[model samples]
Target chain A: MTKVTMTVNGKSVSAEVEGRTLLSAFLREGLALTGTHIGCDTTQCGACTVHVDGKAVKSCAVFALDVEGADVRTIEGMANADGSLSVIQQSFQDHHGLQCGFCTPGMVMASAALLADNPKPTEAEVRHHLEGNICRCTGYHNIVKAVLAASGQDVPAVAAE
Target chain B: MFNFDFVKPSSIADAVAAMAQTGAQALSGGQTLTPTMKQRLASPSVLVSLTGIAEMKGVCLGADGLSIGGATTHATVAAEAGAYYPALADLAANIGDPMVRNRGTIGGSVANNDPAACYPSAVLASGATVVTNKRKIAADDYFVGMFSTALDEGEFITGVTFPVPEKAAYVKFNQPASRFALTGVFVAKYASGVRVAVTGASNNGVFRWAEAEAALSANFSASAVEGLTVSAADLITDLHGTAAYRANLVKVLTKRAVAGAK
Candidate 1:
């Protein structure tokens, strides 16, 4: 095992990690940040998405040692300083973006990254940007709505939701 | 994944030295390698990550055309290569998803040379030069077969220089589940002639459709190759598509690529 150090969620954290330890495992086990989910260990599912140096990436596909001294962020860091929900998270809840909350963390993280890059993304753009993320429960109708709402765009309500 | 020692080198020389060690494997973006490791398919004793080398990143337009660092992420290529080579940028933009693009690098994809990958079609069709630590190789001689390349052990790609084409486009019929091409075609027209490369269709891996090239070079139009057909004999047949289906796609996509070239 080797000691890996990084700024996680605005805090400098260091841990002893095996060379094979994934960043998702490191965050969930080493630092005790369970907010980042791991639905699929493979790269297909985006449940393990997190921001490494301000860019969203699949934490499970990255070795912890590879991100040494990098700045990392998780869903836990999305809320305001008072710990209330951030705009994206609030929008997700308000729009019923999730049914099973398993994929929420990754969805929120990916959405936040999208808004950062393209603040006013269209409906097609949001769907395209979220191609990596999978949500079985919601059929992705409301999830797309939530992301649009988060971007301050007026989202039309679907009768199904 | 098997436990191994890890090293991140800040320079190419140091990275090469580290890779020269026994049982050391070079790791690029790890988009592909990490998953392979998790599956226990690849277990290196020491993983030498090449992302730390500052010099091996970014996209620049040189006298030859576009020079992209080996370690440069697909996202960077999508964002930067548009002005110089918009077709390449479009291909890069559509690779995998946003998160994967952020982590997957050009060198990793080209070096891994997955039969369904997108970059090899672009590289081979554009007549790009694969620059490595040891020497520069022409695209024609770089790719050997599926998941294989001309690269020897300890020799890693540093950058690739693509000769800008007068008109170029890449058209892919992606396997929706994985977003890899079921059969992709790239057509590039230069002053000298036309080059056509097809990926994801052939068992022999990415290859130039010489017949299509000759036809397109003579006419430079979609109708020029209307009568041409790819033989189904060497095409891949799997649950996703049949060899004949892939063979048909090779022709259809090539026509679309030529018509769409800008």
Candidate 2:
């Protein structure tokens, strides 16, 4: 077992985990921060996305031991000090971005990272940036709208086809 | 994943020493290796984390070319290499996603040598050199085949040096599912000659298309190889595409790359 220490959700946390322990597992099981979901287990699905050192990454694809002394931010940390939803999360709700909600945490995390990098992204850029984050529910129409809206862009409502 | 000892070494020498242990594997970024381990595909006895090593990180551009440290993440390359090598920056920026690029290192990618990986195409086409703890291996000699490299056991890749070319461009047809290149081409024009390396479409891994290179050398334009056909004999054929289809992509991508190169 490896003893690892890291800053998670603005708190210094330590855990004794096996070498095979994934960061997603550590966050969910060890620290009881189950907000970070693991959908596909494989790297293709972005359902396990989180931020490490201010960059979004798949927590399932990283070992807990490898992240020693690193800074990790999850969906749980994205709330305001008063426990309100962050702007991106609120935008998702306003845009009806989620249906099943399995992929929302990862989608929101990935979208937040994108907006952090590119504050004003075009619709095409938003779509391209979300290639890794797959949302089967809502057909991704609302998710794209939510990301764009969170970035302070005026997103038009989707017209019924 | 099997049980393994974890060691984070702050120095390359310590990391190499840790690797000397039986069944030890170096971990950088954990983008690829971690997944392999999670699936129980790789059962290493020890994981020597290279992320802690400060010496093997950063981008350095010099007279020789751009020297990228072994542990330098893809995001770093995408953000910093833009001023020096915009084509490389473009390729780096598009790899995986925001998260993969955040953690995946160029050294790990080249060392792992996945055939569909975008960096091998750029490295081979740019005629970069893979600098190791012991010696340097040219890009031509570095990659052997799919998931293969010339790196010996315990021989660490400190970084790679890419010689800035006169003009270079990388274009890839992304495989929808994994976002890996179905057929990627990197076309570079140097003072010496032209080098065109094709990745994700060949059975032997990333290789130089001599025919395209020679054609572009004669006339540096996309239309130069309009009639040139790629042979399907050595192309890769899987569920994604047939060998013949990949051959077509090779020619088409090469033309587009040449036209796109500035």
Candidate 3:
């Protein structure tokens, strides 16, 4: 086992982890940051998305030991300092972006990363960026609307939503 | 994933030394290796993480064209290689997805040489040089077969030097589910001649379409290869597509790639 140290959600934390311990396992099990879901452990689903050193990546696809001393941000960090829902989270909630909420953390994190890079993404750009993230519930219409709303763009109301 | 000792080396020399140890495997990006390990397909006693090596990360334009560091992530390539080689940048941009591209490295993809991968077609078509710690291998001799390369055990790619082509483009008909190429073609036109590489189709893996190359070199047009056909005898046949279907895609995508070459 290796002792790994990293900054998660702006807090420095240390954990004893096996070399095979994935970041998702480290977050959910070790740090009790269960917000980062692991819907598909095979790396196909984006339910495990998190930011490492400001770039979003699949937590399950990375080993904890590899990211030692790096800054990691999970879904738990995507909130205002007052513990209120972040703009993205509030947008997700208002736009009815989620159904079962299993994929919400990942969807929010991935969208945050996309907005960080391209703040004013178009409808097509939003859809393309979220390609890795799978949302079986809402058929992605509302989720796309939520992401656009989070980016401060005017989103059209979907009849289904 | 099996239990192992993880070592992140900050230098290429240190990484090389770490990889020389018994049962040591080089881990760059870990986009593919991590999943494979989860499936228990690869279990190395020690994993040498090469991403920490600062020297092996970046894209630079030199006399030889674009020299891309092996550990440079796909996102980096997509962002940096655009000015030097836009076609290559486009290929890197479309690889996997935003998250996978953030973690996947060019060296890892080229080294893995997955039959359906996108990089081999770019490397082979551009005739890039795969530079290793010990020696450099030409693209022609670097790729051997499916999931195989000329790299020796403990040897890892440090970078690749691509000679920028006058015109180049990569077109892939991806599997809808996996987004991997059902059949991808990369066409590169150099002053000397045109080189065409086909991936995700051939059983031999990422082979050059010589007939298409000859026709394109002579006429550099989509209609140049209208009469050409790839034999289905050597193409891959899987649930995604039939051998004949892939064979047809090879011709069709190659034509499209040539026509779209910029």
Candidate 4:
């Protein structure tokens, strides 16, 4: 077992885990923070997305030990200290960004990063930026809407599922 | 994933030393490796992860060229090296979703030598050097065959040394599910010659399209590749594409890439 230490959300987390333990595994298994989901083994799905050292990444593709001294952010930590939703979260909820919701957390994480960087992304930019996160339900009309809303803009329509 | 002794060495030297032992796999960006592991394709006894090694990070622009650390994520290259290596930067930035780009390392992509990958073609076309613990292999000499490299066991790539070119472009047709290329053409012009490296289309893995390269070498023009015909012989045929389709894509993508570069 290796001693893995890193900051989760805003809190420092340390755990003893196997070397084969992926970051998703550590978050879901060791830390019991199951908000990050693993939907595919081939790295195609963004369902396991999280932030490592401030950049959004797939938790399933990362090893727990890889982030020893790094800072990681997950879906569970996206809320304020008082337990209210963050701006991105509120936008997602208000715009009906989820249906099955399996891909919600990862989509939210990826979109949050995108909006943080490019606050007012165009529809093409939104489509291009969020290409990594795939959803099988509700198409992407509302997801795009959520992103636009988070950017403090009007919602988008006609993004067929 | 197979069971293994996992070790994340805190430094490059330690990572190298750890890989020096028998039956060890050096994990750079686990984007490729971990998936292979989870799928039971690779069952290494020891995993020497480079995540802890600070030396294998960053994108440094140099007087001669760009030297991206082995551990530098694709996102970093796509985000940082835009002015210098537009083809690579765009390809890296857009390879997978934001998640894969954040974790997938250029080193891992090059070392894994995925036949349908985007970076191999860029590395070969740009004449990048695979800087390793053992030796510096030229782009042509580094790639051996399918999922193979000149890198011997225990040898780890320190970083990739790429010389900036006069102009370059990479165009790929991706497999929707895996996001790997169905066929990718990376074209570049150097003082020596014009290089047209074709990945996703060779039984020999990544190879130079001689006919296409010769044409481009003469003029470095899109019209140079306009009439060239790529042979289907020796190109890979798999579920993603037929050998014939790939051969045709080699020519088509090459033309498109050249045009895109212009």
RMSD (Cα, Å) of candidate 2?
1.3
lDDT of 2 by residue, B1-262 (tens): 7889988999988988999999999899888887788788998998898988999999989989999999999999999998888889999999988788888999899998888999999999999999998899999899999888999998878999999988889999999888889999999999888999999998888999998899889999999989899999988999999999999999999989988897
Which digits, one per residue and each the tens of the lDDT, describe model 4 over residues B1-262?
7778888787877887899777899888788888888888888898888766778888887875899888888888988889777877988976866778877888888889988888888889988989987788999899999999999878888889889887888988988777788888998888888898998889878999888888888887778888878889898888877999998898888888888883
Total backbone collisions, model 3? 0
Q: Candidate 2 — which residues are off by over 4 angstroms? A: A157-161
**Model 3 per-residue lDDT at B221:** 98
CAPRI classification of candidate 1? high
Report how far residue B238 has shifted in candidate 4, in Å: 2.6
Pairs in clash, predicted candidate 3: none
Ranking 2 against 4 by TM-score, winner: 2
Candidate 2 chain B: worst-modelled 10 consecutive residues by lDDT: B30-39
Model 3, range B134-163, lDDT digits (tens) per residue?
899999999999999999999999999999
**Tens digits of lDDT, candidate 1, A1-161:** 89999999999999898888899999999888998999989898899999999999999999999999999999989999998999999999998899999889999999999999999999989999999998867459889999999999999776664
Q: Give the Cα RMSD of candidate 4.
A: 1.7
Candidate 1: pairs in clash: none
Q: Pull out the clashing pairs in model 4.
A: A132-B97, A139-A161
iRMSD, model 1, in Å: 0.6
Better of 2 and 4 by DockQ: 2
- Whole-model Cα lDDT of every candidate shown, in order: 0.94, 0.91, 0.94, 0.85
Cα RMSD (Å) between model 3 and the true structure?
1.2
Question: Which CAPRI quality tier does the interface of model 4 achieve?
Answer: medium
lDDT of 3 by residue, A19-107 (tens): 99999999999999999999989998999999999998999999999999999999999899999999999999998899999999999
